[model samples]
Target: MAWELATSCTNQRVVGSSQIQNEAMQIGRKEIKLNTTSRAYVDPDRINELKTISSESFDLSKLIRLCEELNICFAGECYLSMVMLTRAILDHVPPIFGSSSFQQVANNYSGAKSFKEAMQNLENSSRKISDYYLHSQIRKSESLPNVTQIDFSNNVDFLLSEVIRLLKK
Candidate 1:
Protein backbone atom coordinates (compact mmCIF):
# COMPACT_ATOMS: atom_id res chain seq x y z
CA MET A 1 0.00 0.00 0.00
CA ALA A 2 1.16 3.52 -0.80
CA TRP A 3 1.50 5.85 2.18
CA GLU A 4 1.00 9.57 1.83
CA LEU A 5 3.27 11.99 3.69
CA ALA A 6 2.31 15.61 4.24
CA THR A 7 5.59 17.42 3.98
CA SER A 8 4.66 21.08 4.31
CA CYS A 9 1.84 23.61 4.20
CA THR A 10 1.10 22.91 0.53
CA ASN A 11 3.20 20.01 -0.68
CA GLN A 12 2.31 16.30 -0.20
CA ARG A 13 4.09 13.19 -1.41
CA VAL A 14 3.26 9.51 -1.58
CA VAL A 15 5.72 6.87 -0.50
CA GLY A 16 5.80 4.07 -3.07
CA SER A 17 5.91 1.13 -0.65
CA SER A 18 5.32 0.03 2.93
CA GLN A 19 9.03 -0.43 3.55
CA ILE A 20 10.54 2.88 4.65
CA GLN A 21 14.08 3.39 5.89
CA ASN A 22 12.80 5.47 8.82
CA GLU A 23 9.43 5.42 10.57
CA ALA A 24 9.19 9.15 9.94
CA MET A 25 10.65 11.09 7.03
CA GLN A 26 12.07 14.59 7.42
CA ILE A 27 11.01 17.12 4.85
CA GLY A 28 12.74 20.45 5.48
CA ARG A 29 12.07 21.12 9.19
CA LYS A 30 8.91 19.01 9.48
CA GLU A 31 8.62 15.29 10.17
CA ILE A 32 5.81 13.63 8.21
CA LYS A 33 4.57 10.03 8.09
CA LEU A 34 1.45 7.93 7.81
CA ASN A 35 -0.38 6.06 10.53
CA THR A 36 -1.29 3.06 8.46
CA THR A 37 -3.05 0.60 10.72
CA SER A 38 -6.51 0.97 12.19
CA ARG A 39 -8.09 -0.86 15.11
CA ALA A 40 -11.63 -2.11 15.88
CA TYR A 41 -12.46 -2.80 19.54
CA VAL A 42 -15.96 -4.08 18.89
CA ASP A 43 -16.50 -6.74 16.26
CA PRO A 44 -18.27 -5.28 13.24
CA ASP A 45 -20.02 -8.59 12.67
CA ARG A 46 -21.60 -8.33 16.12
CA ILE A 47 -23.00 -4.89 15.26
CA ASN A 48 -24.21 -6.26 11.91
CA GLU A 49 -25.93 -9.12 13.72
CA LEU A 50 -27.73 -6.66 15.98
CA LYS A 51 -28.83 -4.70 12.90
CA THR A 52 -30.21 -7.85 11.28
CA ILE A 53 -32.56 -8.52 14.18
CA SER A 54 -36.00 -7.18 13.37
CA SER A 55 -37.86 -7.10 16.64
CA GLU A 56 -41.15 -5.36 17.26
CA SER A 57 -41.07 -5.66 21.04
CA PHE A 58 -37.71 -4.01 21.52
CA ASP A 59 -36.42 -0.86 19.83
CA LEU A 60 -32.69 -1.49 19.36
CA SER A 61 -31.84 1.78 17.62
CA LYS A 62 -30.23 3.43 20.62
CA LEU A 63 -28.46 0.29 21.67
CA ILE A 64 -27.02 -0.26 18.21
CA ARG A 65 -25.97 3.36 17.97
CA LEU A 66 -24.15 3.12 21.31
CA CYS A 67 -22.36 0.00 20.16
CA GLU A 68 -21.33 1.70 16.92
CA GLU A 69 -20.02 4.69 18.83
CA LEU A 70 -18.14 2.39 21.19
CA ASN A 71 -16.33 0.86 18.21
CA ILE A 72 -15.45 4.26 16.80
CA CYS A 73 -14.19 5.62 20.11
CA PHE A 74 -11.98 2.62 20.72
CA ALA A 75 -10.54 2.73 17.21
CA GLY A 76 -9.80 6.43 17.54
CA GLU A 77 -8.06 5.81 20.90
CA CYS A 78 -10.70 7.71 22.86
CA TYR A 79 -10.50 5.45 25.91
CA LEU A 80 -12.72 7.59 28.11
CA SER A 81 -15.39 7.83 25.40
CA MET A 82 -15.24 4.10 24.88
CA VAL A 83 -15.64 3.42 28.61
CA MET A 84 -18.57 5.80 28.86
CA LEU A 85 -20.23 4.22 25.83
CA THR A 86 -19.79 0.78 27.38
CA ARG A 87 -21.42 1.99 30.59
CA ALA A 88 -24.28 3.41 28.52
CA ILE A 89 -24.81 0.07 26.82
CA LEU A 90 -24.82 -1.77 30.13
CA ASP A 91 -27.45 0.67 31.37
CA HIS A 92 -29.50 0.38 28.18
CA VAL A 93 -29.71 -3.42 27.73
CA PRO A 94 -31.34 -4.51 30.98
CA PRO A 95 -34.98 -4.54 29.83
CA ILE A 96 -34.10 -6.83 26.96
CA PHE A 97 -33.04 -9.45 29.53
CA GLY A 98 -36.35 -9.14 31.43
CA SER A 99 -34.76 -7.10 34.16
CA SER A 100 -34.89 -3.50 35.34
CA SER A 101 -31.13 -3.19 35.87
CA PHE A 102 -27.87 -4.77 34.72
CA GLN A 103 -27.12 -6.09 38.19
CA GLN A 104 -30.42 -7.92 38.17
CA VAL A 105 -29.68 -9.28 34.71
CA ALA A 106 -26.34 -10.55 35.86
CA ASN A 107 -27.84 -12.28 38.88
CA ASN A 108 -31.26 -13.47 37.68
CA TYR A 109 -31.13 -14.08 33.92
CA SER A 110 -31.30 -17.75 32.92
CA GLY A 111 -28.28 -17.53 30.70
CA ALA A 112 -25.19 -19.75 30.63
CA LYS A 113 -22.75 -19.36 33.50
CA SER A 114 -20.27 -17.71 31.19
CA PHE A 115 -22.85 -15.21 30.04
CA LYS A 116 -23.73 -14.41 33.62
CA GLU A 117 -20.07 -13.99 34.43
CA ALA A 118 -19.58 -11.62 31.54
CA MET A 119 -22.57 -9.57 32.65
CA GLN A 120 -21.32 -9.47 36.22
CA ASN A 121 -17.88 -8.32 35.09
CA LEU A 122 -19.41 -5.49 33.10
CA GLU A 123 -21.75 -4.61 35.91
CA ASN A 124 -19.09 -4.64 38.58
CA SER A 125 -15.85 -3.73 36.87
CA SER A 126 -16.76 -1.53 33.92
CA ARG A 127 -19.39 0.30 35.90
CA LYS A 128 -16.91 1.08 38.66
CA ILE A 129 -14.34 2.30 36.16
CA SER A 130 -16.96 4.36 34.37
CA ASP A 131 -18.13 5.81 37.64
CA TYR A 132 -14.57 6.70 38.62
CA TYR A 133 -14.10 8.54 35.38
CA LEU A 134 -17.53 10.09 35.41
CA HIS A 135 -17.70 11.30 38.96
CA SER A 136 -14.16 11.88 40.12
CA GLN A 137 -13.12 15.51 40.49
CA ILE A 138 -9.89 16.83 39.10
CA ARG A 139 -7.11 16.15 41.58
CA LYS A 140 -3.57 17.36 41.99
CA SER A 141 -2.12 14.08 40.78
CA GLU A 142 -4.29 12.34 38.20
CA SER A 143 -3.50 9.39 36.00
CA LEU A 144 -5.20 9.01 32.63
CA PRO A 145 -6.67 5.78 31.40
CA ASN A 146 -4.97 3.85 28.62
CA VAL A 147 -6.22 1.21 26.17
CA THR A 148 -5.25 -1.69 28.42
CA GLN A 149 -6.98 -0.12 31.38
CA ILE A 150 -10.26 0.32 29.45
CA ASP A 151 -10.30 -2.81 27.32
CA PHE A 152 -13.50 -4.72 27.90
CA SER A 153 -13.75 -6.01 24.35
CA ASN A 154 -14.07 -9.72 25.03
CA ASN A 155 -16.62 -9.25 27.77
CA VAL A 156 -18.61 -6.95 25.52
CA ASP A 157 -18.48 -9.42 22.64
CA PHE A 158 -19.75 -12.15 24.90
CA LEU A 159 -22.57 -9.93 26.07
CA LEU A 160 -23.44 -9.03 22.46
CA SER A 161 -23.46 -12.67 21.47
CA GLU A 162 -25.93 -13.43 24.25
CA VAL A 163 -28.09 -10.50 23.20
CA ILE A 164 -28.18 -11.81 19.65
CA ARG A 165 -29.12 -15.27 20.93
CA LEU A 166 -31.89 -13.98 23.19
CA LEU A 167 -33.34 -11.63 20.57
CA LYS A 168 -33.42 -14.32 17.91
CA LYS A 169 -35.37 -16.67 20.15
Candidate 2:
Protein backbone atom coordinates (compact mmCIF):
# COMPACT_ATOMS: atom_id res chain seq x y z
CA MET A 1 0.00 0.00 0.00
CA ALA A 2 2.80 2.41 0.92
CA TRP A 3 4.79 1.57 -2.21
CA GLU A 4 1.72 2.22 -4.38
CA LEU A 5 1.26 5.64 -2.82
CA ALA A 6 4.98 6.42 -3.30
CA THR A 7 5.08 5.47 -6.98
CA SER A 8 1.73 7.11 -7.72
CA CYS A 9 3.22 10.58 -7.25
CA THR A 10 4.13 11.45 -10.86
CA ASN A 11 4.58 15.17 -10.14
CA GLN A 12 7.47 14.69 -7.75
CA ARG A 13 10.41 16.77 -8.83
CA VAL A 14 13.56 18.04 -7.13
CA VAL A 15 12.72 21.66 -6.54
CA GLY A 16 14.95 24.47 -5.12
CA SER A 17 18.36 23.80 -3.67
CA SER A 18 17.36 21.16 -1.14
CA GLN A 19 17.56 17.57 -2.27
CA ILE A 20 14.26 16.90 -0.54
CA GLN A 21 11.13 17.37 -2.62
CA ASN A 22 7.90 18.85 -1.30
CA GLU A 23 5.65 16.10 -2.60
CA ALA A 24 1.99 15.72 -1.74
CA MET A 25 0.97 12.59 0.12
CA GLN A 26 -2.65 11.56 -0.37
CA ILE A 27 -4.43 9.68 2.36
CA GLY A 28 -8.09 9.05 1.62
CA ARG A 29 -9.58 12.51 0.86
CA LYS A 30 -6.81 14.41 2.63
CA GLU A 31 -3.69 15.30 0.71
CA ILE A 32 -0.92 16.89 2.72
CA LYS A 33 2.45 18.06 1.50
CA LEU A 34 5.25 16.38 3.32
CA ASN A 35 7.82 18.66 4.92
CA THR A 36 11.08 17.70 3.31
CA THR A 37 13.08 20.25 5.21
CA SER A 38 15.01 18.29 7.80
CA ARG A 39 15.43 19.70 11.29
CA ALA A 40 18.41 20.06 13.54
CA TYR A 41 19.42 17.72 16.37
CA VAL A 42 17.23 19.19 19.05
CA ASP A 43 15.86 16.74 21.57
CA PRO A 44 12.52 17.80 23.09
CA ASP A 45 13.08 15.65 26.16
CA ARG A 46 16.43 17.27 26.85
CA ILE A 47 14.86 20.68 26.38
CA ASN A 48 12.26 19.84 28.99
CA GLU A 49 14.96 18.67 31.34
CA LEU A 50 16.86 21.92 30.94
CA LYS A 51 13.72 23.95 31.43
CA THR A 52 12.81 22.25 34.72
CA ILE A 53 15.25 24.17 36.93
CA SER A 54 15.89 27.13 34.66
CA SER A 55 15.75 30.53 36.37
CA GLU A 56 16.68 34.12 35.78
CA SER A 57 19.26 34.07 38.55
CA PHE A 58 20.91 30.87 39.74
CA ASP A 59 22.70 30.52 43.07
CA LEU A 60 25.82 28.48 43.73
CA SER A 61 24.04 25.20 44.44
CA LYS A 62 21.64 25.49 41.53
CA LEU A 63 24.56 26.27 39.26
CA ILE A 64 26.27 23.13 40.48
CA ARG A 65 23.17 21.08 39.83
CA LEU A 66 22.84 22.45 36.31
CA CYS A 67 26.50 21.70 35.68
CA GLU A 68 25.94 18.11 36.69
CA GLU A 69 23.07 17.84 34.26
CA LEU A 70 25.18 19.39 31.53
CA ASN A 71 27.94 16.89 32.23
CA ILE A 72 25.45 14.07 31.88
CA CYS A 73 24.29 15.43 28.56
CA PHE A 74 27.86 15.78 27.31
CA ALA A 75 28.67 12.23 28.35
CA GLY A 76 25.55 10.96 26.61
CA GLU A 77 26.78 12.57 23.38
CA CYS A 78 23.82 14.94 23.17
CA TYR A 79 25.79 17.86 21.81
CA LEU A 80 22.88 19.96 20.56
CA SER A 81 21.08 19.48 23.84
CA MET A 82 24.25 20.42 25.69
CA VAL A 83 24.70 23.57 23.60
CA MET A 84 21.11 24.65 24.18
CA LEU A 85 21.63 24.10 27.89
CA THR A 86 24.87 26.03 27.72
CA ARG A 87 23.08 29.04 26.23
CA ALA A 88 20.36 28.74 28.84
CA ILE A 89 22.92 28.60 31.60
CA LEU A 90 24.57 31.72 30.29
CA ASP A 91 21.28 33.56 29.90
CA HIS A 92 20.02 32.47 33.32
CA VAL A 93 22.61 34.55 35.15
CA PRO A 94 20.76 37.83 35.31
CA PRO A 95 21.60 41.54 35.78
CA ILE A 96 21.82 42.18 32.09
CA PHE A 97 21.76 45.66 30.47
CA GLY A 98 18.05 46.08 31.11
CA SER A 99 17.48 43.27 28.59
CA SER A 100 17.84 39.49 28.36
CA SER A 101 19.89 39.44 25.20
CA PHE A 102 23.12 37.44 25.42
CA GLN A 103 25.15 40.51 24.47
CA GLN A 104 23.31 42.57 27.04
CA VAL A 105 23.87 39.91 29.66
CA ALA A 106 27.50 39.85 28.81
CA ASN A 107 27.82 43.63 28.50
CA ASN A 108 26.08 45.11 31.55
CA TYR A 109 27.05 42.36 33.95
CA SER A 110 28.07 42.99 37.55
CA GLY A 111 31.75 42.31 37.05
CA ALA A 112 34.25 44.83 35.72
CA LYS A 113 33.45 46.31 32.32
CA SER A 114 36.50 44.63 30.83
CA PHE A 115 35.49 41.34 32.36
CA LYS A 116 32.00 41.76 31.02
CA GLU A 117 33.47 42.45 27.62
CA ALA A 118 35.35 39.19 27.83
CA MET A 119 32.14 37.45 28.70
CA GLN A 120 30.51 39.03 25.66
CA ASN A 121 33.28 37.64 23.51
CA LEU A 122 32.64 34.23 24.92
CA GLU A 123 28.92 34.66 24.42
CA ASN A 124 29.41 35.65 20.79
CA SER A 125 31.65 32.65 20.20
CA SER A 126 29.21 30.25 21.78
CA ARG A 127 26.28 31.74 19.90
CA LYS A 128 27.88 30.68 16.62
CA ILE A 129 28.18 27.15 17.91
CA SER A 130 24.56 27.26 19.03
CA ASP A 131 23.38 28.54 15.65
CA TYR A 132 25.32 25.79 13.97
CA TYR A 133 23.39 23.34 16.10
CA LEU A 134 20.16 25.22 15.53
CA HIS A 135 19.87 25.33 11.70
CA SER A 136 21.17 21.76 11.69
CA GLN A 137 18.88 20.86 8.78
CA ILE A 138 21.77 21.94 6.57
CA ARG A 139 23.62 18.86 7.66
CA LYS A 140 20.61 16.60 7.37
CA SER A 141 21.83 14.56 4.41
CA GLU A 142 25.52 14.73 5.24
CA SER A 143 27.50 12.79 7.82
CA LEU A 144 27.58 14.82 10.98
CA PRO A 145 30.82 15.40 12.83
CA ASN A 146 31.25 13.88 16.26
CA VAL A 147 30.30 15.97 19.25
CA THR A 148 33.33 16.66 21.40
CA GLN A 149 33.39 17.07 25.15
CA ILE A 150 31.46 20.24 25.89
CA ASP A 151 33.89 22.88 27.14
CA PHE A 152 31.34 24.54 29.39
CA SER A 153 33.53 23.30 32.25
CA ASN A 154 35.63 26.47 32.45
CA ASN A 155 33.03 28.79 31.01
CA VAL A 156 30.37 27.68 33.43
CA ASP A 157 32.81 27.71 36.33
CA PHE A 158 33.92 31.26 35.56
CA LEU A 159 30.42 32.59 34.99
CA LEU A 160 29.04 31.06 38.18
CA SER A 161 31.91 32.36 40.29
CA GLU A 162 31.57 35.80 38.75
CA VAL A 163 27.82 35.84 39.34
CA ILE A 164 28.39 34.80 42.94
CA ARG A 165 30.94 37.56 43.33
CA LEU A 166 28.60 40.09 41.80
CA LEU A 167 25.82 39.03 44.14
CA LYS A 168 28.10 39.57 47.10
CA LYS A 169 28.64 43.20 46.14
Candidate 3:
Protein backbone atom coordinates (compact mmCIF):
# COMPACT_ATOMS: atom_id res chain seq x y z
CA MET A 1 0.00 0.00 0.00
CA ALA A 2 1.27 3.49 -0.95
CA TRP A 3 1.08 6.65 1.18
CA GLU A 4 -1.51 8.11 -1.23
CA LEU A 5 -3.73 5.06 -0.67
CA ALA A 6 -3.39 5.21 3.10
CA THR A 7 -4.01 8.96 3.29
CA SER A 8 -7.50 10.27 2.50
CA CYS A 9 -8.41 13.74 1.31
CA THR A 10 -11.14 15.55 3.20
CA ASN A 11 -12.63 18.86 2.02
CA GLN A 12 -15.55 19.75 4.27
CA ARG A 13 -16.71 22.85 2.40
CA VAL A 14 -17.18 23.81 -1.21
CA VAL A 15 -15.31 27.02 -2.19
CA GLY A 16 -17.94 28.56 -4.45
CA SER A 17 -19.95 31.38 -2.84
CA SER A 18 -17.10 32.95 -0.83
CA GLN A 19 -15.38 34.49 -3.84
CA ILE A 20 -15.00 38.22 -4.42
CA GLN A 21 -17.33 39.80 -6.92
CA ASN A 22 -15.91 40.67 -10.32
CA GLU A 23 -16.14 44.38 -9.54
CA ALA A 24 -14.57 45.45 -6.24
CA MET A 25 -11.81 47.80 -5.21
CA GLN A 26 -9.45 47.11 -2.31
CA ILE A 27 -8.13 49.84 -0.02
CA GLY A 28 -6.18 49.68 3.23
CA ARG A 29 -8.39 47.89 5.80
CA LYS A 30 -11.38 48.79 3.62
CA GLU A 31 -13.11 47.90 0.37
CA ILE A 32 -15.02 50.05 -2.08
CA LYS A 33 -18.06 47.94 -2.95
CA LEU A 34 -19.98 48.95 -6.07
CA ASN A 35 -23.72 48.71 -5.57
CA THR A 36 -26.45 48.72 -8.19
CA THR A 37 -26.85 52.49 -7.74
CA SER A 38 -23.20 52.95 -8.65
CA ARG A 39 -22.37 53.79 -5.05
CA ALA A 40 -19.81 52.37 -2.67
CA TYR A 41 -19.80 51.61 1.08
CA VAL A 42 -16.47 52.31 2.74
CA ASP A 43 -14.99 50.21 5.59
CA PRO A 44 -16.30 46.95 7.01
CA ASP A 45 -17.86 46.34 3.61
CA ARG A 46 -21.58 45.53 3.81
CA ILE A 47 -22.48 43.46 0.76
CA ASN A 48 -25.71 42.04 2.06
CA GLU A 49 -26.64 38.57 0.77
CA LEU A 50 -30.28 38.94 1.76
CA LYS A 51 -30.73 42.51 0.60
CA THR A 52 -34.37 41.89 -0.34
CA ILE A 53 -35.19 39.98 2.85
CA SER A 54 -36.01 41.93 5.97
CA SER A 55 -33.81 40.97 8.93
CA GLU A 56 -36.48 41.52 11.56
CA SER A 57 -35.90 38.02 12.89
CA PHE A 58 -32.10 38.23 13.23
CA ASP A 59 -29.33 40.66 12.45
CA LEU A 60 -27.99 40.19 8.92
CA SER A 61 -25.44 42.97 8.70
CA LYS A 62 -22.69 41.22 10.62
CA LEU A 63 -22.98 38.07 8.56
CA ILE A 64 -22.84 40.08 5.39
CA ARG A 65 -19.79 41.91 6.65
CA LEU A 66 -18.14 38.53 7.04
CA CYS A 67 -18.85 37.88 3.39
CA GLU A 68 -17.47 41.27 2.47
CA GLU A 69 -14.32 40.82 4.51
CA LEU A 70 -13.90 37.48 2.80
CA ASN A 71 -14.17 39.22 -0.54
CA ILE A 72 -11.68 41.83 0.59
CA CYS A 73 -9.28 39.23 1.94
CA PHE A 74 -9.27 37.45 -1.40
CA ALA A 75 -9.51 40.39 -3.78
CA GLY A 76 -6.76 42.15 -1.85
CA GLU A 77 -4.70 38.92 -1.69
CA CYS A 78 -4.20 39.20 2.06
CA TYR A 79 -4.56 35.76 3.59
CA LEU A 80 -3.71 36.98 7.08
CA SER A 81 -6.53 39.53 7.17
CA MET A 82 -8.99 36.99 5.80
CA VAL A 83 -8.08 34.51 8.48
CA MET A 84 -8.38 37.16 11.17
CA LEU A 85 -11.79 38.33 9.97
CA THR A 86 -13.17 34.81 9.71
CA ARG A 87 -11.98 33.76 13.15
CA ALA A 88 -13.12 37.03 14.67
CA ILE A 89 -16.61 36.55 13.28
CA LEU A 90 -16.80 33.07 14.79
CA ASP A 91 -15.50 34.31 18.13
CA HIS A 92 -17.94 37.21 18.11
CA VAL A 93 -21.13 35.21 17.43
CA PRO A 94 -21.04 33.20 20.65
CA PRO A 95 -22.50 36.06 22.65
CA ILE A 96 -25.43 36.23 20.26
CA PHE A 97 -26.18 32.64 21.20
CA GLY A 98 -25.16 33.51 24.77
CA SER A 99 -22.56 30.76 24.63
CA SER A 100 -19.45 29.75 22.69
CA SER A 101 -20.75 26.78 20.74
CA PHE A 102 -20.65 27.47 17.02
CA GLN A 103 -20.51 23.72 16.26
CA GLN A 104 -24.15 24.68 16.81
CA VAL A 105 -23.30 27.64 19.11
CA ALA A 106 -25.40 28.93 21.94
CA ASN A 107 -27.17 32.08 20.73
CA ASN A 108 -29.78 34.10 22.52
CA TYR A 109 -29.84 36.65 19.73
CA SER A 110 -33.19 37.94 20.92
CA GLY A 111 -31.56 38.91 24.19
CA ALA A 112 -28.76 40.70 22.38
CA LYS A 113 -28.31 44.39 23.06
CA SER A 114 -25.56 45.87 20.93
CA PHE A 115 -23.75 44.31 18.00
CA LYS A 116 -20.64 46.47 18.37
CA GLU A 117 -20.16 45.61 22.03
CA ALA A 118 -20.66 41.90 21.49
CA MET A 119 -17.98 41.93 18.83
CA GLN A 120 -15.64 43.87 21.08
CA ASN A 121 -16.17 41.46 23.95
CA LEU A 122 -15.28 38.49 21.79
CA GLU A 123 -12.29 40.27 20.25
CA ASN A 124 -11.00 40.75 23.77
CA SER A 125 -11.95 37.19 24.76
CA SER A 126 -9.24 34.61 25.38
CA ARG A 127 -10.49 32.12 22.75
CA LYS A 128 -9.79 34.55 19.92
CA ILE A 129 -7.60 32.87 17.33
CA SER A 130 -4.61 34.83 16.06
CA ASP A 131 -2.69 34.45 12.87
CA TYR A 132 0.85 33.14 13.32
CA TYR A 133 2.17 35.44 10.61
CA LEU A 134 0.62 38.63 11.99
CA HIS A 135 1.65 37.88 15.58
CA SER A 136 5.17 36.90 14.61
CA GLN A 137 5.99 40.34 13.19
CA ILE A 138 9.56 39.51 13.98
CA ARG A 139 9.88 36.50 11.71
CA LYS A 140 12.19 33.80 13.00
CA SER A 141 14.13 31.37 10.85
CA GLU A 142 12.58 28.47 12.77
CA SER A 143 8.99 29.66 12.32
CA LEU A 144 6.83 27.85 9.82
CA PRO A 145 5.72 29.48 6.59
CA ASN A 146 2.61 31.64 6.49
CA VAL A 147 -0.77 30.04 5.75
CA THR A 148 -1.55 29.71 2.09
CA GLN A 149 -4.36 31.64 0.41
CA ILE A 150 -6.11 28.43 -0.61
CA ASP A 151 -6.23 27.14 2.97
CA PHE A 152 -7.51 30.45 4.28
CA SER A 153 -10.16 30.64 1.56
CA ASN A 154 -11.39 27.14 2.35
CA ASN A 155 -11.51 27.84 6.07
CA VAL A 156 -13.44 31.04 5.46
CA ASP A 157 -15.96 29.15 3.39
CA PHE A 158 -16.49 26.48 6.06
CA LEU A 159 -16.70 28.96 8.92
CA LEU A 160 -18.98 31.28 6.96
CA SER A 161 -21.51 28.52 6.30
CA GLU A 162 -21.42 27.34 9.92
CA VAL A 163 -22.10 30.87 11.18
CA ILE A 164 -24.89 31.35 8.68
CA ARG A 165 -26.53 28.10 9.71
CA LEU A 166 -26.37 29.16 13.35
CA LEU A 167 -27.93 32.54 12.54
CA LYS A 168 -30.74 31.04 10.47
CA LYS A 169 -31.63 28.93 13.49
Question: Of the candidates numbered 2 and 3, which has the greater lDDT value?
Answer: 2
Off by over 4 Å in 2: 1-64, 96-99, 138-140, 143-150
Q: What's each prediction's TM-score?
A: 0.76, 0.51, 0.44
lDDT of 3 by residue, 11-60 (tens): 21322222233233222223322322211211222233333335355576
Q: Native-vs-model 1 lDDT?
A: 0.69
Q: State each model's C-alpha RMSD to the native.
A: 9.5, 16.0, 14.9
lDDT of candidate model 3 versus the reference: 0.40
Query: Which residue pairs overlap in candidate 2's backbone?
Result: none
lDDT of 2 by residue, 16-124 (tens): 1111122221223222222211111222233333334434554344444455445444334456666777777676655423456667777666657767766776688
lDDT of each: 0.69, 0.47, 0.40
Which residue pairs clash within candidate 1? none
Model 3 RMSD in Å is 14.9
Alpha carbon lDDT at 7, candidate 1: 25
For residues 12-74, write the lDDT of model 1, one tens digit per residue: 232211112222223222221212222455666777788889888898878777776664454
What shift in Å separates residue 103 of candidate 1 from its native position after superposition? 0.4
